[model samples]
Target: MIKNANIGVVLVTFNRLEKLKKTLESYAEQTLYPQYIIVVNNASNDGTTDFLAEWENEASPYKRIVINLSHNLGGSGGYYAGEKEAIKLSASWIMVADDDAYPSADYIEGMDSFIQSYIGGRLAAVCGSVVEKGSYALWHRRFKRKGFSLEYSEVTRPEDYQKKDFEVSYISYVGPVMNKVALQEVGLVDKDFFIWNDDIEHMQRLGKYGKMFCVPRYELHHDVDSQNSALSWKSYYGLRNNLVLLKRYFPLRFLIVLSLLTAKAILCPLKGKCLQEMRLRLTAIKDGLVGNLGIHPVYKPGWSLKKSV
Candidate 1:
């Protein structure tokens, strides 16, 4: 509806070609089409690159480009790569999505309308509501603090969301559209994060420029499982990165918080006998405190790391 709104989308994915295909289909089905779509593939070995090459050969309506990464640099690095491509494309506003988020037909229209709103001028980033495709449940989680530690217990809805926009401290990397102006002022995402806490750090930067909002009226189908996989090992990065963030940004509170978390790492597992909260978790805490980062080569037995495309 808005003329000459060159909305460029940056999609980051790895090893989820089927999900990526569905997302591409969903993007193609949008009522308001993007000017271009820049996909950042983090060296997927699942025929993802070949599949996208095939997509390019099809009679696709919108312009599409793919940036094939050399390594599995995780989501943050993937997003950083996409942001660079978006800037080069001279996008008016950049929309970001993970492979699993499937935007509705009016997704871009809603984003455009949100950007055209009165407070839109100050909105650094805007995100849409996401519902779990299988459970039909709200996707974001409600977090609470229990003195130096945090807990994720309840479902989070936009409490102040009337029929439209509402404030949010954080939003999942499901479907976030950011104003290029704000991005120019705030700068790009932290690639050092490599995955978790990258969005949080990026949002924290945006706060210095303007606020982030969620327009809960617009919805998307997010079909990923809510809980962590039983054999998953991503917790290493998640835990290490957040602790590293706290140490870097919250210097004065870091030691006390770290001490508390270290105690929790030792004492909590003893109480629950959880293997996930094992000695390896303490190793992560140590790794975070010492500032060691990047793709961890240490994987469990039975798993292999395909480092590149």
Candidate 2:
């Protein structure tokens, strides 16, 4: 571990108290613990606030800090808020994680070692491999090289990363370690995105300043299958934000590839699947056309309890 580096781990959560607890448990067992742990509670009504307070009171190793927002800020907002706090704390490196991802005991140690070795002044951010919890299948894949096209391919196990440091188009924010200096140079995640594609957008900006690396040896366990599942609003933002990203950074050839992919999604063969995809695509396009990128909040039934403990 880099003893000189003050690393802060930031976790963003909504109502997944149980998953957050699991993530914390894994963090508590880390071989190379962060200087501090910050949890951004996004207006959760599911006893999340009380649970955080309780966890803070009974912490084992790392310093526990919680910042409760008055309303839901979505993933992008939560990450931006956490990153801002991390910068305020003067952390050299900030590790961003989802509430459901659990890193192994040596995960941070591996990341620190990798960063110390390959990350000259040119390295801005480092991303780790994310493996599914149950099936152990690939969830997150390696990042595309600077001039390469973006593709979602399966990553193999035993998690050995490519050695050389290279410029990447984007890296997964699920378990990415960001350099504060780079963030200050490029700016934090775009709050306009609200959620989807925010990480990609941030990485794209950071690439202008320095290189982004993927440390596959440092792996995390994500409890969900990110590849297959797609929430309605997530799909909408993804399609819209991808368009925005493509328009901003992608080359003309890649733009054509993206358009083809979008067309395929809109014109899939199966009736049910095609209609659903088309609806999401159309809604996203409509929202983009009218400058309505923000999505309406959807609360679960009976979610407005006065107090949860």
Candidate 3:
């Protein structure tokens, strides 16, 4: 261990018992174990509780804190809750990852060393490199500016990141180690963003506080087979949150993004997998433009977002 590194690793999970187990197993094998493992369970009806009961009871080298919520708080809310708990632990560093993010055994070691190497550097966080499980392709390792807004660089090659470290405009939630100093400086993660784009919004805000860098030397496996826009509810939240983030961080680019949304809405039906997906996108854009956010009926049967709101 790195002598009281005090790195707290937070995870937000729901209805992903098996995936969560694998992720925890990976952490258990880490060469440099985190001081704390904080997991925010988003009201999972699955056997996650029972699994965790057994898992946490096993011998471990660190503290395991599990927060079971009363209801499903979505990704953003779960992360916020977990991060808050990690912060309360007075950890010097905090690293949050999704349930499916499986890091290499040396990932924690590499990150600990990287932070130690940059004792006097202005680093907001160190985002680890993530590769798609099946394709083995690097997931947008670079964050950058697009037309009036932010965008990710194209799928990168492994050799592209041969450098020890490189600066980035944003950090993904796949796996990013953050120092308490930077966390307090940037502020808490926004809970309003119930799902997608929450990480992007937080990263944008965080970039203003300090610099972000990608450490490809640290490896991660993001078990994402594909990103099909056909998932109505997923696409809905994604676009909705994307618009909300764009407006929050890049108001000048609001119209630019809005214009693009309009185009997508108009042509989506023709190119999209089905009319349902197109409609979801349209509804997302409308709600986004009107600043409307809440639980929607599409996610639950016979229920409406208004009820939750």
Candidate 4:
């Protein structure tokens, strides 16, 4: 372990007890253990509480700090709470990851190594490369762009990242090790975001303070297998928060994003599930345009929009 690293790893989870268990197991394999493992339970109704209770008791290398909230705070809120706790703990570095994100044994070691070697002033964070299944996840290592445009097509091959670290525009929640100084300057994750694009918004702010880079040398396994084609409650969060981010960071590009969303909303009916998809998209557009965020009572996981609308 790097001497006086004072690293704190924060994980946000909700209703994924088994996956979280695997994540914790992965942490046990880490060569460079952090000072603390902060797991924020977003009020999961599953056996997460009991599992965490037992797991924390039998901890080995690091102190496990578990924050059990009374209600589901979503990923953004969970990170906000967990990171706040980490900041209070006076950790020099704070690493945030999803419950399903399993970092490689040498992940933290690589990050600290890079940070130590980096001559760049005011380093914001280092985003670790993420792998889905056996392939490198290109989407996780996104290109930072000015305005509302996003680019991940810069590097076609994952092998290209093997040789050198690249500065990133976007910061995914997969595995980004942040400096506490940057966190203190940027403040905590926006609880208003509740979920999607919260990282994007936070990334925009972090850029102002310091440089952010992606070090593919450090890897993490993201076990998510969710289908992108499916439009669910999360689509609402994605759409609305994206709009909010566009307006906040790229005011000039706001109308362009709005236009694209409108076009998508209009053409979404072509794919069938006409009314359901259209209504959902339109509702998202309306809420986004009006800047109405937070959990929508009508739009929730496993809950259909057809019933309410």
Candidate 5:
């Protein structure tokens, strides 16, 4: 609806080629198309690179910029790179999404409408309602901050969210449309985070500038499992990054969180895969405390340095 609005869409992906394809199709179906679609491929070995190459070569209505990294930078690094590029393109607003997440047909249109109407330099960012599977996924919620320790509360009743836009203290990477000026002031995402909690840190930065809102009219479908099992590589990054954030924000609370994680690691089952997970958790705690970041060699997705019994 808004003419010549440079809305850049940045999508970060790794190994999820099928989901990425569906996401791209969703983008194509948008009522209001973005000026640029920037896809940051994190060196996925699962034919993702080949697929992107073909997609980029194909004819499209809008411009497609694909950046294939030599190594996997994880979500944090990937988003940093993509958003930086979006800023360089002189995008007035930037929208970010994961490969497994996509917006509804009028998603971008609604975001632009809000930007043109309600956002008169008062709002830093705006996110849409995220629906996973068939039900309302309360991935976007308010985060209560206490001495740098962050906790979020979900809406028990999804029907409570009316058509009106609500203020949010926290914003995730899923389908958030960010203003360029706010991004320039806050700077890019912390690539050092490597994975989890980067969005929270970015949300904190944006909160310094202006208020962020969640417009329920714009919907996005996120294909993600809300639960994480006990044994997972994600445990390492989540625990480590959470500790890093705690230490950076509140040093006193850091020790308290560290002690709890240490106890969990020690009390974990001592045999089989649980033992492996325990070892990884302990390593994460150490890394978080010492400010050791970047992708862990031993603890990674799909592959890990498993110890023998």
Candidate 6:
């Protein structure tokens, strides 16, 4: 069993300054502090730079480091950069976190113990449950898969995941603590997927090497504030990246799911904000048919934000 594993935390942030600060504070409060805390700023025009400067000035015993990227590399790029840094620091494990999410005080401690107990090194990744803030709406919907009756659909507590470990085709990468050795064997996140589905793709790849566990005992609050409107660019990426993920991983299954989802989006255009979602789905299909890849700005000159909503 791996003992005294040196862990590193990587947090990626964009324009959310307040949430990011809270996440950092959570990191500082960890019982077993990470050897390195790296924050990758994804070119936020907001006061993110200033806030980082102020945070740097405030003395903290933990080792805190920040890397400001000139352009917005999106979530995939930021994680890629952070992973590289963690490797350079010789970290045995890397905990990836979204700027809006923060772990419990005993998060790292629990993860370390869990790792030792189950020989986590043999697994590709270990992830925790993400508790949604405010209404708990997101959390409720996460496992609410219609048409299929999942045994663990109603699980809300850690004890719900009592099963030792199992293989999953898809696993959330929001705040997963990955095994450095497994990562080296399977490779890193797909950089082509700028945002969404990158985690799904990585999970799919990792499953080839070893198992992934959802350690529900260790939880974190994923702060997802309700937004008034959907950004056109975000819709584009969600649709486009999902298409890429489907093509790269589950081509046949994706086609079937896409067709069903598309039909649903068209029929209930207004409900669940399906109108905007339909647009993204269609556009993603078009982009895939035409063969488009790599990074592109969310907002273009002609794209109407109102039309998207």
Tens-place lDDT digits, model 4, residues 52-134: 99888893778888999999878988999998899988668899999999999888778878888899888988977888988
Q: Model 3: per-residue lDDT, tens digit, 1-309? A: 334355889999999888999999999888888888988888888999877777667777888888998988788889999888887886788999999989999888888888778865587888678878544445545556465663533445567578777777766788988867877888878886678777878877777777777777677888775664335456677788888877776777777888888787778657844555566778888888888875665653223333433
Candidates arranged by lDDT, highest first: 5, 4, 3, 1, 2, 6
Please identify model 1 stretches exceeding 4 Å from their true place: 1-4, 134-155, 158-162, 229-231, 267-277, 299-309
Which should have the higher lDDT, number 2 or number 5? 5
Reference-based lDDT, each prediction: 0.73, 0.72, 0.77, 0.82, 0.82, 0.69
Model 2 earns a TM-score of 0.79
Cα RMSD for candidates in order: 4.5, 5.7, 4.0, 2.5, 2.7, 5.2
Writing each residue's lDDT as its tens digit, candidate 5 over 1-309 gives 334345789999999999999999999888888888999999999999999999998887678999999999999999999998999886699999899988999998888888878835568888888888876777565644445443433442465467588778777899898989999998989998888889887887888888888888788988986774545677788899998887877677777888988988888785333676677888999999899999998777665444322
In model 6, where do residues sit more than 4 Å from their true spots?
1-5, 57-59, 134-169, 227-231, 257-281, 297-304, 307-309
Number of residue pairs clashing in candidate 4, backbone atoms closer than 3 angstroms, sequence gap of 3 or more or interchain: 1
- Using alpha carbons, what is the TM-score of model 3? 0.87
| Residue 65, candidate 2: C-alpha displacement in angstroms | 1.5
Give a tens-digit lDDT track for model 2, residues 123-173.
Answer: 787876677754433434344544534442234433334543333446677
Question: Residue-wise lDDT of candidate 1 within 101-163, one digit each (tens)?
Answer: 898888988888777764544777787787785443443522223333223223455464445
**Model 4 worst lDDT window (10 residues):** 147-156
**297 Cα displacement, candidate 2 (Å):** 6.7
Best candidate (score: TM-score): 4
Comparison by TM-score, 1 against 2, better one: 1
C-alpha TM-scores of all predictions = 0.84, 0.79, 0.87, 0.91, 0.90, 0.78
| Each model's total of backbone clashes | 0, 0, 1, 1, 0, 0
Candidate order by decreasing TM-score: 4, 5, 3, 1, 2, 6
lDDT, candidate 5, equals 0.82
